[model samples]
Target: MIYIQLFFSFLKIGLFSVGGGYAAIPLIQSEIVNGHGWLSMQEFTNLITISSMTPGPVAINSATFVGLRIAGLPGAVTATLGSIFPAVILVSLLSLIYRKYKGTTAIDTVLGCLRPAVVALITAAGLSLSQTALWGELPVSLSSVDWTNALLFLGAFFILRKWKWNPILVMCLCGAGGLISFLTGKFF
Candidate 1:
């Protein structure tokens, strides 16, 4: 029964979440956090962080993590499968349709219009995640802020913009820095 619920929940996420994984964050949050109460907002935020740092889509990673937390390995498999199934089917269908309408102006126009909407979805997801990542559930006041995290974010943004470093390298460096901070009791 748990496995079935996990599968269907993620299946809903995969089916309706257009514009990719970031766009699915809100849906995933609603199901696992708000609906099921399986994870708190902070836990969900951490899940997103971990998902971003790992391979595969954020939606798949999140489904697997949440499923494992909820119902072990079987739940993980079911949720991961559910999260990918719609994408696989939709892409297959879209490929055929795109081939058939390869040069149609209507199709081109539709695709062009979708681009901005996708961008907007991604931006909204980022903003939603930022609220948690930057301040957790604390009130939006200067005294309640995590200054270390804010500093890290600013430093990372500056370095990335100035040096255009490889994103993987930046992530690794930040991970190492975080580990060091943890070991030294500088970050909590």
Candidate 2:
């Protein structure tokens, strides 16, 4: 039953996760965090970080991770298969359609229209994640903020934007900073 649930949850996620993985974060959060109560907001944010840090698409990685957390290895496999299944079918059909309508204006118009919505979705995901990261507690109190995370977020953003540092490297550096801070009791 859990396996079936995981499968269908991710199936919906994969089927509707247009504009790739980042855009799918909100949908993942809705299904996994809000609807199912499988993971808390903090855990979901951490899951996003871990999913992004690892290889492959974020949506698929998130499906595997969440499934594993909920029901172990079998759950992971079931969820991953669910996540990929829709993509496989859709891509195949879309490929055929694209080949047939190679340079159609309708295709261009559809894609052009989708771009803004995708951006909006990504922005929404980012804002939610930022809220969770910067303000660890509710009510948005001043003392509830995680200063270390805020610093890391700012510094990482600066370095990535200013110097175009490799994202993996920035992730590693921020991770190391967090680890060092935790180990030394400097900040959490």
Q: Top lDDT: which candidate number? A: 2
Candidates in order, TM-scores: namely 0.92, 0.96
lDDT of each: 0.87, 0.94
Candidate 2 displacement at residue 114 in angstroms: 0.6
Q: Please, what are the lDDT tens digits per residue for candidate 2 over residues 94-173?
A: 99999999889999999899999999999999999999999964779888888899999999999999999999899999
TM-score of 1: 0.92
Residue 144, candidate 2: Cα error in Å is: 1.8
Candidate 1 wrongly placed segments (more than 4 Å): none
Model 1: worst 10 consecutive residues (lDDT sum):
142-151
